[model samples]
Target: MIQSLRLATALLSGLVFGVGLALSGMLDPARVRGFLDVTGAWDPTLAFVLAGAVTASGLGTALARRLRRPVLANSFDWPTRSRIDFALILGAGLFGVGWGLSGFCPGPAVAALSGRSLPVAVFVVAMLAGMAAHGAARRVLLVR
Candidate 1:
């Protein structure tokens, strides 16, 4: 019962996020492209969206930290990487390129499945393939 409730809450939160993204014009490819093309025709609207997201996420994390026990887990699994390395930089560059080309990040891509976008479907498949390949490569490298 508790597990089902947790899953329902998570799904509901994701649905709300997807609706917000769609309503806020973030789901439009042109808006993302405009934000990236800051040299010719700079559009700073996405900056406000990013700022608001960061603020809300920061506050939410703070609140979660104050809780004695997490509702769905033993504890939070926060990343310990404080310093950016070559792998991190390279991965980020690749992700940015993919985002610019497809205009559909992971969460939005899944959310867009209901919107009948063929290209989003392709992007999601390719993204999953890349992730699978990365995992395999990591396993191989770690064994050697």
Candidate 2:
């Protein structure tokens, strides 16, 4: 019963997220590039998308902390890491560079794939490969 509820919630959340990405023009790589262009024809549409996401996340976080346990999980299981570490900073820098160059972050890239775009497909494939490589490297390198 609990597993079913969790699955249902996951599906619903993914659907809503995909709809939001599509409706907010986040799935468009050209729009994303425009936003990143800054001095040249910068688009501010993504700012509204960020604002909406932050607002929703803030409210959801506040409500979640008030709960003793998650509705679909045994516990909150939030990340333990809070400090700004070297790995975190390096990873973020890499992510930002990749997002800027490709005009597609993980979520937007995945959502955009629904349109059957060849570039998006290639991006997703490369992203998945990178993820797999990272996992393998972590297993061999990281002690924690």
Give the winner by TM-score.
Answer: 2
**lDDT per residue, candidate 2, 33-144, as tens digits?**
8998999999998999999899999999999999999877889988898999999999999999989899999998998888998999999999999999999999989766
lDDT tens per residue, model 1, 1-144: 888988999999998999978877687777888888879687889898889899999999999889977888777887887998998999999999988887767877887777888887888899999999999999999999
Shift of residue 44 alpha carbon in model 2, Å = 0.7
Which sections of candidate 2 miss by over 4 Å? none
lDDT of 2: 0.92
TM-score of 1: 0.91
Which consecutive 10 residues in model 1 have the weakest lDDT in total?
Answer: 22-31
Deviation from native of the Cα of residue 141 in model 1, angstroms? 0.9
Report how far residue 133 has shifted in candidate 2, in Å: 1.0
